[model samples]
Target: MRLRHITGSEDFVADSPYVVHRSERYRGVWNRELFPKPQPIHLEIGMGKGQFITQLAVLHPERNYVGIERYDTVLMKALRKRESAEAAGCRLENLRYLSLDARLLPEHFAENEVSKLYLNFSDPWPKARQANRRLTSQVFLDCYTKFLRKDGTLEFKTDNTGLFDYSLESIPAAGWTLLAVSRDLHRDPVLNEGNVMTEYEEKFSARGNPICKLIAAPPK
Candidate 1:
């Protein structure tokens, strides 16, 4: 599902008045007109090219999705895809993007605001000193606890074995209970189905690397 040239000419004003501002950062917010009723909010950090969340938003229209990507170059692709989805009138009223750092999550969302968090093929800072920067680190997980609901879930996938192993050990320390873990996602078709492959995932899986996935929940 790769395109030779994604629409990149249209620039989005991050500070547009319509955008929601919190603690100096901007992100799109869904109004009551879009949902009619309050819906559960789900977030995906580092949503590369928006393939995963875009499909998820279309499939689960009952829930709202927010994708956070720091890089505008890559973020534009996701926006284009979302715009196309919206133009078709295909149930894309629930999706939005945030160009901000993952560390700034607390400022934008209130306590118990997010129901689920997705981390897919995040950067694996393989060095020891850089471990804190990993998205699955205890520090970041602790930050998420501030916004995640009591029964909130964190779904993660990565092709890096080191990161996967590190997460398996860090989740408990961060006060999250590991619910499901898989070293080879392809073996389980049910969960794999409708799972949109990211740019990195498509490349690594093509090389025969088994993708690792896990589901963790905040301890009640």
Candidate 2:
């Protein structure tokens, strides 16, 4: 998918307090002082257009929410959404964005720092050779384990069956225990309740696509 490059997106991000300019500088200090109340940090990796993470931040003001995106153009959209929300009198003090690659997670987060991780409709990287690039691949799972707390849960939702299957296998292979699995997320009334929808999730599910979801935790 071609991203519409927003002119001055980089400049906007640099000026916004919501975007962490030098994320690595904070590192282990994020929880101590970055957010107002030192709440448990919940991260949404590959946050597209900011829908899910932003809504989560609004719904749960007690928790700190961070949305990480690699593309400046995409991150800009997410940042703008926060601005719009604030303009409409929404309090988003606990929300923030990081324009960085997922691979650098360890450099910016301390061990057991993140309380929960969300992977929403990440790139499938379907080709056999590109399998490792999938967010659910062992490469990324290993990276997540380093930052997630002992009982930290990683919740994932995707429309791609191949990627979902791969994640089911990869999680256990990486020594994480699968806590829950749902092939059809919306069908499960228990999981569907209070489930925030991502941009892709709403688009796909409207077309009758069965969304896949799972929750897994690092082994103790």
Candidate 3:
């Protein structure tokens, strides 16, 4: 997706206390350094506008949440949503935002540090030659193995059928196991329960687009 430069976004991200700067310094001790209490760490890659993660942070205060967005222009929007959530009387101290590339996750995190990882509607990189760029591809799955615990899991949601299908094949080929899968998540009452919708998810669902979800366990 082409991003239009948003004026002051870079400044806003730099100045926000919710944004974690020099995050590499806190690698192995993210839970110790970021939150008042040490707890399980849940990370969201490509956390677009922050709606999904902010809600997750509020709903599960026991967990430490980190959201990563590559662009300051995009992260600024998430910061505003986080602020709005706080204004509406939501507690989100356990949540923090990072303006970083997804491919660099291991550089900022230690081995077996993440408890759960979420990938939501990531760019599909549709071209066949660009398959390695998909979050579920072998390259990224290898990257994930470095930081995810033996029992840690990855949850992914997307409206793109091709991407979802690719993930279905890629994850298992990478030696991971699927715990759950739903081709139409909203139609599955069991899965839909406690599901938080991202802005794009809501828009797509409203248009009758099916949302696919999968829970994958890392190889031990």
* Total backbone collisions for each predicted model: 0, 0, 0
**Model 1 segments more than 4 A misplaced:** 1-36, 87-89
lDDT of 3 at 22: 95
Q: Write the per-residue lDDT of candidate 2 for residues 1-220, one digit (tens) a residue.
A: 6778888988877888888878888898897768888999999999989989989999999999999998888888898888889898889989988988899999999998899999999999889999889888889989988899998999999999999999999899989999999999999998888999999999999999999999999878
TM-score of each: 0.85, 0.97, 0.98
Write the residue-wise lDDT of candidate 3 on 30-51 in tens digits. Answer: 9888888898999999998888
Q: CA RMSD for every model? A: 4.1, 1.0, 0.8
| TM-score ranking, high to low | 3, 2, 1
Highest lDDT scorer: 3
Assess each prediction's global lDDT (C-alpha) against the native.
Answer: 0.80, 0.91, 0.94
Name the regions of candidate 2 deviating beyond 4 angstroms: none
Model number with the top TM-score:
3
Give the C-alpha miss distance for residue 140 in model 2, angstroms.
Answer: 0.8
How close to the true structure is residue 118 of candidate 3, measured as C-alpha lDDT?
94
